[model samples]
Target: MHFRHQTLSSALAMMASLACLSPLQAQTTGAQAPVISQSDAQHLTAAPSKLTLLTLLEAAWSRQPEAQSYTERLRAAESLRAASSAWTADSPAMLLQGKTDRPGSGAGSREVEVGVALPLWLPGQSQRATALSHAQILALQGSMKAQRLQLAGLVREGWWQTQRTQTELALAQTRVANAQQIALDVARRVKAGDLARADQHQAEGAVAQAESAVAEAQGAYEASLHALRGLTGLLDLSPDNLEATSEGDVSTPLPSADALASDAPSVDEHPLFAEAMAQQSMASAQADLAASSRRASPELTVLTTRSRGQTGDPYQQSITVGLRVPFGTGARADARQAEALAAAQEAQAMTLQMRARLQAQAASALARLRSAHTQWQATHRQAQLAQESKNFFDKSFRLGETDLPTRLRIEQEAVQAQKALSRARIDVSAAWSAWWQALGELPKP
Candidate 1:
């Protein structure tokens, strides 16, 4: 009874598995199954501890639509590579022509020819096929590299955006707190006849304005988190404290421009360029195949036949050497070959142009990084001075030595200084990202 119960349960599970494998769902790739909207999936996963830049990149690689596309392309290339190396069979053929004799009164007969052939070896066919397959493998690797770099850049940028929003939100909250304290003091002074009712009203207006700014900042912060979570597949992203001190030896001493340029590979080696080159190579191979189709190849043929005419001698056998010559497609083969050569030349030229463009972009990105680093140092010093000034003004205001307008002005200056500092950090981070992209190093493990 126990065994029977277990068997029944196994059957039920098998049925459930079959049901889950719906035709429509089965059609989609596993990688494509993660198509749930960012908002919907956000709740499904727990927030990770200390989510680093690499972790975010990995998540994007797993979930992004472009990743799926590259993966599918790689699979297709592999399948094609296998097909190119395998043997294939052609068609069966037969022929018959005869006339029947009626009771020995009259008789008529005619001869007929029939044959069957298969490819033995076509010149340049195997070499061209192997080269095309190798090219495709290299092309697919290049595409995968490109996709990884893109995902890394996106994740880093999203991380910075979220950080910046959090910084802004915190600053806004500080302003609101200060404004509230000032409002309370003015209201007390008005009740004690030390300040006018108009001053109290101005303080109240300032408080209201600060509150509105806080609300706006909070909204922006939340939006940034949502955007980040969409990319990283991490839902509960919250603002964390940023590093206050700069790490030592932040500068990267780069090699000479000539040296760097010399290290760069040719256009055919770059991912997109290589893919295009591979495609052109494949086209050329296909044209060669078409040309080969016009030539005849030797094949050993053997046939066994059952003749219906003679009752005693029904069995017959024959052996022959067979060949096939393409009758009409040779001219078309030349035309296709010419077309392929033109396409290959075009791809080569495009690759050269792309390499030039990529080099220029790399140079620009490096220059930008240097400029951003210098600017950030200056901005950091300015922020420090602004903070000191705000502190001085705050003390004076508390001692009744400074007016409300003067205090507000100092606070605004400090706020602007902090914002500039944040922007400078953001700029430096962006420059680093661009530099990585130019070097094709963003997706490196």
Candidate 2:
């Protein structure tokens, strides 16, 4: 009980804090937000415990309006089978008639009759209607699934972006520490007359520049985090919640498409395809129902009649049978059948269109992944070369063999190379994410 109370209080506090922040400030933090450890990925403060990507996705799914709408519609559709009459008329109706004669002749007479009629269904109309409702419910289920896939896509995109931001912030902090250390070393060298005063000044300038970079990186990270929160409607989401890739993160080398091909789900497993199939079935079912409706079904009625005869006349009681059939000129039936056929045709066309769109999307994402993977490899090589060049320049500068400008240029190249490499790796990861989405293989809530 105490633990639950504590958790509630903590959540309330967090909400209060969030409420205090304006939308603008959410993106550009005026106060320091919680720091994330890119190394361990643990939250740096006391926060909601045991939050995971799956849990967050589930929470967001519950909040999604479209998903909820389809879910409700499915339930309603399911209930329709019961709402529909198993037979055409749920109950029987009563029929009564009476007649009276005035004293035009020697005797006056009065008579009355009472009867009951029971309605019935056609041969198979009741069953067909029930089946049609079930088909509609199935289509609604597929629609709900498609909506969930959309939500999952959003989560994946935001997850990768947050991963990139976390890595960038870490890199920026490391750069700042390195710059500060170099500045202190230069100061000592200048004091010992081993380096020029201008060298020390340049080192200090680099330290200041690094500090500014850290601030900028921090801002970008905060913005990305805010965007993720808005997208998922889960403010407690963090880097640790996401599934770590095989190499551990967006910065790591990911498996090639060929490596994953064997385990990859086929395009037929996609939600778009499933949804289209369901809709096509629903339209076809509707057409069947319309065609069946063309055969007119009339109610079956059973009745008992009671008659009171006039004075001096014999008492007579007899049962009268009747048939009621709805007659149509086939015009209405043709119009309805034609309308249903048109709808089925439209649904078939839409299914084809969706397949074409998915195929195009899959192809585009695959091409991007291949190109981005190659570029990431090239950037990795570039970083290695830049690191070696920076080392050579550092040694020469320390020995007074390289000018300050030359040394500064080499350091800048190394820093830019690292940044470029980070961006390329992120691109590859994002492209892979898109590929997965294109295949409609999103992780379910």
* Candidate 2 structure, TM-score to reference: 0.72
Q: Write the per-residue lDDT of candidate 2 for residues 1-445, one digit (tens) a residue.
A: 3553354345445435545654233323323665545543431222245444455557667667876677577678877867554555356678777666754553556556677766666556677678778888878888888988888778777767776776676666556555665665576677788888788778878977977887887787778877766565554554444444521234545445663356556656789888998999889888888887875667666555554456677656777788877775498899999999899999999998988898788778778887888898899999999999999988987787887778778888888889889888878877877877887876533
Once superposed on the true structure, which residue ranges of model 1 sit more than 4 Å away at CA? Answer: 1-39, 42-44, 65-76, 87-117, 240-302, 328-331, 443-445
Give per-residue CA lDDT, model 1, range 216-322, as digits (tens). Answer: 86677667777777777665554322222121113555435663467645434455555555555655665556555554443434333333343343434344555
The TM-score that candidate 1 achieves is 0.74
lDDT of each: 0.62, 0.70
Q: Please, what is the TM-score per model?
A: 0.74, 0.72
